[model samples]
Target: MTSPIQQPSRRAVLRMVAGAPLLLGASAALAVATSAPALAAQAGWRWCERCSGLWYSLNGTRGTCPAGNVFDGGHHSNGSGNYILKTVEDGGRGQGNWRWCGACQGLWYGGNPTLGYCPNRGATGHTPIGPYPTISSYYLIEDVGNRDSPGGQEQWRWCYKCAGMFFDGNTPGGSGRCPKDGYTHSVTGGSYVLRQVP
Candidate 1:
């Protein structure tokens, strides 16, 4: 008679089979991590956006964005239809929050036309040119020659609710009601003095 044959335990066999997939997954993850540097090297440029500012780096050499945000793999839109993968030099003017004045075809600063005047029009006042967050704060001041003032520049108003700058043009003349917030004080009388940017 043959000696009793040895057999593997059922539990042991199951454990081995289950562990195979886990081992394979771990190996695959390791491979991807190891290849990441190579992929980054192949990348031509990278960009990062932060509350403080936008930044860029070449060939993956740049560090993380401010506040420890990771740099994205590609370029980002400047909200002006242009894809930017690098920081733009704006002389010493710094980045400006500007709005387009359609009537004058120029730009005004700080969203309030009354606070400042158009580039070419002196302090004639501003009209609601378009939506906020224009493409670029920088605009070419067009010489539209001399034309009648649009006559509806929003008066500088302060909203107690939003604590943001409100324009009188949004409401009827002499009314202090904010569009987003109910009645507030008009900071510029019914009108405001225009200060042009140099």
Candidate 2:
């Protein structure tokens, strides 16, 4: 992507194409009404919305660019499918790093903030948590036999020690224990605690 200064003036270029009013910060509809020359508005341009490094005038109602873009549409996002934007390429750090706002579903730049991605970016891991053989202190439920999702008839547990999953509550490949005999699962983060059933 081109840097802000290197970017061509939106108005100058637009005028050559269709003679749209160069609102000098004036929005096509709401472009700043400053009466500045179109070239000036395009020169010190700032983005209205944020994502994938795209920006538009703060004045206009939202709409897609001639180029196909998802956020360009008026519809806002929940930031479930967000990405990063930077003045620097290849995820590099610099004075301009953007964080996708899950609420606005837009990119916010100019803050030089810590780098982060939205949770919907698949940040969770699928690591095996526990195969606990004996009851756990944190959990307080009776153990029920393992259950499986539909379309199958099998369940597995993870051995916290061996760091492997085992079948039928076996301790094989695991060091974690199934709570004594009357425990239920109480999951936290990526781990589970066995709770005694009332």
Candidate 3:
């Protein structure tokens, strides 16, 4: 005759029931992380102390700056902080159409039908750094208007005069120098935040 099957002990049943919630929670966390959009970030973008404009510093040649230079008339990065820029390919959580200008090495908006003003290009407009279709378009996250991102530096704005991104975080109510304008860069758009690359 076959023996009857034994039932699990009361203690064993209680242990599994207690651990069920923990296992489920872990699975939920993993799912959320995997479903999130991927963010690609590049460091070496920096603020220009002289012109107060944002520029890419990874290149060997420093592009022209609106503010004249002592040596080569290029962008002066003295005491400037290195910033990290993120590109979300899926159009996630930020403003798009931001592009790197090869002509001046400054970041400018590329969405306009007419190319915006470029100090280096002399009214021709800023040139995108890379070739067509392969050019990198960046997404800038606004740090203003109820979006408080404490991890990045705030008060960075788009210059209406130059159509280039510039820093307005100076003391005593002074905006950084503008290349297009003889004086400071005029802020008109959203306040953007850029994380300093440590």
lDDT of each structure? Answer: 0.28, 0.24, 0.69
Backbone atom clashes (below 3 Å) for every candidate: 1, 35, 1
Q: Give the per-residue lDDT digits (tens) of candidate 1, residues 20-105.
A: 65555667545544431112111122112221112222222332221232334222313211111111112121223443343323
Candidate 2 lDDT, 1-198, residue by residue in tens: 112223334444555545554434435434432222212211211222222112222223332211224544442222212211222321111222222232222232223232222212212211111122221111111123221111211232322222112123222422222121112222221222121111
Instruction: Please identify model 3 stretches exceeding 4 Å from their true place.
Output: 1-39, 131-133, 145-150
Q: What are the clashing pairs of model 3? A: 66-179
Q: What overall lDDT, based on C-alpha atoms, would model 3 receive against the true structure? A: 0.69
**Residue-wise C-alpha lDDT for candidate 3, range 1-198, written one tens digit per residue:** 010112232333445656666555666655534442222355678888778889888767578888865577888788988786665443456777888887788898777775677777877888875433346677787765533234668888988777889888787545877766578888886788777756
Predicted model with the maximum TM-score: 3
Error of 3 at 3 (Å): 72
Clash count for candidate 3 is 1
Query: Candidate 3, 19: how far from true, in Å?
Result: 33
